[model samples]
Target: MEFVERYNGSGLLIEVEKILYEFKGVQHIQIFQTKSFGKMLVLDGKIQLTEKDESFYHEMLVHPAMLMHENPEKVLVIGGGDGGAVREVLKHDPKEVVMVEIDENVVKACKEYIGIDRGALEDPRVKVLFEDGLEFVKSCKDKFDVIIVDGTDPNPISQALISSEFYRDCAKICDYFVTQSQSPFAQPDYFKSIYKNARFKNKAVYLGFVPTYPHGLWSYLIASDRREIVLDLNVIKERFENRKIETVYYTPEVHISAFALPRWIVNLIS
Candidate 1:
């Protein structure tokens, strides 16, 4: 049987297939779906977290920056309401992690249903701020060691967040900035526009790959003011090999390989 389960506040209606299983530990598991995406498993059967390959999305977003930065402290995550990004950031042992999510309902639903975050909300270093990310960055005086923008696609409402002005503010407040720059294969124009705007202010610009997103391949942009991202292949591989931390997705080889792209993609951006 099928039934409609409305996300309490977000107004996102998800159609549930069946009650899969319950995790007595933290969050329960249930399978569900929406029109845009296909079948998905909901933790506690409430939050819709992943459809097929969530690991690709989570890992690609988190690891590149964490491994790239020699030492990162004070991270600002904008729009990752699910807390997956926070969980990954904590692995680097940052002093503080602040997540600014526009919708509190997303956070509530994920915590209650999706167990993918692995209790990142409970971490002592994490501070979840339910507010607009654009506004939060405007008043932020302190610069961050790393800034990750894990936001949704640019719709009418999110246009401002992708605007040149917002990127300007990001440049002023962040030492190093990384954001989902859109799929180069699907959204080449959007990618070019964002890349051009970022280059105006940033000294270094780089792109990485993410599978399981739209177009079967996605892109992320990294920029810094003082430092150019020097991806030392040998150093990254060695570090991944020696990492004491447990990682399901990111390895040293994968970390270095993600940066490698096709010649056509390279030529387009170059």
Candidate 2:
């Protein structure tokens, strides 16, 4: 029995039932099990997701942007090696889902261990590419209806994902964009930096709470070139009925509420 503490000292620790996997490639990756959070995925000492509440994180990360896109036929998922975002994207019945994961180990480990990713990678519409997401975006010519960046924390390995140039490249290729921005309470500067650098016609910040992550507050940024996010419950409900989409967390009401932020946090972004 052992305890793993988050890097930022959030005072939340997980008691490990056992170590399922560990590797040190681009960064340290560890998959373990806990009594509270169930199966845990940790990267660089940062808790990424837990099986118990993964639906909350994954649903929040993918659905808001997905629903806003009138027709999300083609989708791109960068750095979601665990396939949680891919699973959510497939719910929209996209024609294609291109997943670019920098580390292959994460995909391999999660495929065997993470329930959220089960059967997600094997879907006919999903094409997995093992490469650097930044380089892949730079050289790619195809455009997508939506792009979701389910990347790790902004460490050296993921620095390019947050760059102004990278966001510009993303804007050029996709109509709708979404990414897992860190918790505002923990990394306020980084959170503000993303909003500052993302050059999009329409943008909004939304949040979801996952107990396993730092600060228990997970933030996602949604950007678009053509569409303003539809916050109306009636419209969102209509879309859900049309698609017959089922999710554990995201709903029409939650979508509207997620964008409503605290005054202090809104001030930081503004």
Candidate 3:
């Protein structure tokens, strides 16, 4: 079988050996086995993560904000049903991580098949809540050092995650907020909407490469209540060294350079 992603006159097809799992619940979920990327998880026909290069997406999403914070003892992750973002956040030895996933079926599917989480779902420090992310953020009383929005693309149902109302609630509860902003190249409308709506005290859009994602590139928006969205390179390097965190794709240099967007992308934000 072949798994194909087609949109906007572009597509990616992967040769699949088997369909490991299929289900329809709050959202359609499918798992495919491919010799190249290992098992791939597709949620609502969009490639969420593949076993091989998921680090490129997850590490980029979780770490820059995690490291930018002086000490992220408490982290709140929204919509990371697969647990990949949670796994990366655990390396920081946070005191607690509150993971709010909307679909429990997605959580169960990834736990049994995807394996990207690597047991992050079962960590004692993690508290998994099955609820709508936007609603949860609005009702949450506890503050966090970092908040990671790991939701899906900017579709109609998921637009609330990237909305101004959501960012306002986030700003009240967290010092640093990071979110996947879709691919600036392949889905310019979605990315532009997110950047334009994010009216934080300070914000920056960082770059990363996710092969299976649209346009083979992805972007993330990091915002802070402080005047700075990112710390200095020297400070970042020093903090990263002190943490002694092991990562497959994230580095102090990468964290600093990711903010150096192309002129056009910068123009979109400005």
- Candidate whose TM-score is highest: 3
Per-residue alpha-carbon lDDT of candidate 3 for residues 149-177, written as tens digits (9 for 90 to 100): 99997666577998999998998999899
In terms of lDDT, the best-performing candidate is 3
Scored against the true structure, residue 245 in model 1 reaches a CA lDDT of 48
- For each candidate in turn, the TM-score is 0.78, 0.96, 0.97
Write down the lDDT of every candidate, Cα atoms only.
Answer: 0.67, 0.87, 0.90
Q: Mind giving the per-residue lDDT tens digits that candidate 2 earns over 100-138?
A: 998988988898887677698999999999999989999
Pairs that collide in candidate 2 are none
Q: Model 2: residues >4 Å from true position, as ranges?
A: 7-9
lDDT value, residue 21 of candidate 2: 85
lDDT of model 2, residue 178: 94
* Models, CA RMSD each: 7.1, 1.3, 1.0
- The reply for model 1, stretches above 4 Å from the true place, is 1-52, 200-211, 238-243
Q: How many clashes show up per model?
A: 2, 0, 0
lDDT of 2 at 6: 55
The order of the candidates by lDDT, greatest first, is 3, 2, 1
